[model samples]
Target: MKKVKKIIWLIGLIYVFCAMVNGDAVISSITTEAETTPIEDSASYLPDKEGKENKITDPNNMGDSKKEHLDSEISSGHIISQETLNKIYEQNGEKVAYLTFDDGPAPGVTPEILDILNREEIKATFFPIGENVKKYSDITKRIYEEGHDIGNHTYCHIYKEIYSSPESLINSLKKSDEILQAVLGERYHFNVMRFPGGSFGDKLAPFRKAVNEAGYSYIDWNCITGDGEVISAPTDRLIETLKKTSQGKEKLVILMHDSATKATTAEALPDIIQYLKDEGYSFKPLSQIEEGY
Candidate 1:
C-alpha cells in the first residue's frame, strides 16, 4: 500500500512539473510547488514615488500611478468639464464619443471592421500592435487614408516583458514605431499611442514621461467593451457589458480589441455602433495634443 501511494504521488508530481514546463498554469492559482520555481517572467518591478522596485500590488487599480491631467496643448488649460459632455456636437463640438480599437489590424476581423466603418461614414481610432502593423500593411494605410485615426499599442502585448523595465517599454514602442514608420513612411504621424495594459501598469508615470518627451500623447481608456475579457461571451453579452459599464458616462471613451482572430470584438461592433447611434452617441477620432509631448 505504501509503495502504491508513493507511485501515485510521483505521477502527480510529474504532471505538475510538465504543466510548469509548458507554461500553462493560471497565474492566480499558483501553488507552493509553483512558487518553488518563480514564473519565468516576474511581475513588472516599477519604482513608485519613493523609488522602490517592489510595491504593493493593487489588483483593483487600473494601473494609473498618477491621476489623469489636462494636456498642456489646451493653452486655455481648461480641463473638459463633465457638463461639457452632456451636449453633443457634429462637425464641430458635438457630444464627445470616442470609439477606439486596440491591438488590431487582424487579417479578417480588421478588414471587415474597416469596411463597416467606411459604410457608416464615420472615422474611429485604431491602436495597432506591432506584429499586426507589419503583417497587415494595407489596413494601416486604409485606416489613415479613410480618415480614421491610427494609434500605437506597442510592438507586443506581453505585460511583464514590456513593463519589466522602463527601457523595455520604450524598446517595445520603438519596435512598433519602426514598423509603422517604415510602412507608412516618416510623415505618417502617429502621435497618439496606448500602453498595452493601459496607464494602470506600475510604470505608467515613468513610461508616459518617456513617450511624452518623444513627442506623443499617452491615451488611457476610461471605458472598455469587455470583448477582451472573455472569449465565450456572446455578442449580446458583449453589448450588454459595454452598455452597463457606460451607463452614466457622458463622453465615453470606449476601449475595444481588434487584433486577435478569436477575440470576437468585430462581431459585437455593428450592434454596438447601432445601439450607440440610436442612443444619440457620435463617434470621433482621438486628436493628438502637444501637452504631453
Candidate 2:
C-alpha cells in the first residue's frame, strides 16, 4: 500500500510538470506572433526602437493652408479698403502689387500659369472673358478652386458691341457675371468688373457709375507687360517691360494676359515674380482690395 501511494504521488508530479511546460509554450507562441505580425492599420500607436510612437502629422489632412485664410470670417473674397491700403502704405511703405490676368482660361497658357502659381504658392486675380469661360469652363473652375479671385471681363469681348454705350457695357457685364455665376455655382459671387479696354475712356463714366452703384467696383492696371499691345513680345522683353513700368510705383496693379498667344508671359513669369520679390513687393489678389469696399 505504501508503494502504490508513492506511485500515485509520482504520477501527480509528472502531470503538473507537463501542464506547466505546455502553458509556457502556448504563451511563447502568442508573444512571437504578436511581435511578427505586421500592423497594417496604424503605425502611429505602435512602439518604436525608442519605445515611443510616431507623431501623426496633419491628422485632419486639410492640405490647403490658403483655405483657412480665404474662408476666414474677416475677409473672404474681397479686397481691403482703399483707405486701409493707403494707411498700410503710409505705415509700412512696403511696395504692394496686384497681379491681374485678363482674357484667360486659355488652353495651354492658363494651366501652365496655374501650375507655376501653385508651385510658388502665390495668388493672383483672373478676369476671364465670358466667351473663354464658356469654352474653358473647367479651367475657369480650376482658377477659382485653386484660391485665385475672378472678375467679369465681358462676354462678347467685341469692343464695338460691348463698348457701344453705358447700357451696352452694363449688359455685357451682366452677361459675363452670369457666366461666372453659372460656372462657379450659387455660393460664388464676384462684384468686380474690368472694362474691355479699361475703366478709362469717356464712354465708361456712366457705365462705371451704374456698376459702382450696383455694388461693383472697376479695376484698372497701372503697369502692364504690354503683352496685349505687343503680341509677339519676347520673354526677356516682357520681363524688361514689367521691370521698367513698375520701377517707381509704390502700389502697382499689373495687367498681364493669359491668352493662348501669350506664351511668352508664362515663360517670363518666373523671372517677373523674382523681380517683384527682389523689389520688395508683395503679390495680392484683387479680392483683398475689393473686399475693403
Task: Give the Cα-based TM-score of candidate 1 against the true structure.
Answer: 0.64
lDDT of 2 by residue, 1-293 (tens): 99999999999999999999999999999999989977544223434579776643332344467345334632434533334433423323657888889988799999999998998888999999998999999999999889999988888889899767777878888888788878887557767778778878776778777767666777788898989897769998888888899877887889999988999899889899999998888888866653333
Q: Each model's TM-score, in the order given?
A: 0.64, 0.70
True lDDT of residue 193, candidate 2:
70
Clashes of each: 8, 10
- Give all candidates' CA lDDT scores: 0.71, 0.79
Q: Per-residue lDDT of 1-293 in model 1, one digit per residue for the tens?
A: 99999999999999999998767545545765656855334233447889977654332443443212211221211122222322222134234568888888877788888888888887888899888888889888788778787777889879889888778888888889889877777656656678877777554778777776665567666667787777546778888888897775666778887766434677788888998888787777765221112
| Error at 286, model 2, angstroms | 1.4
RMSD of 1: 24.4
The Cα RMSD of model 2 versus the native structure comes to 8.8
Q: Name model 2 segments beyond 4 Å from true.
A: 1-92, 290-293
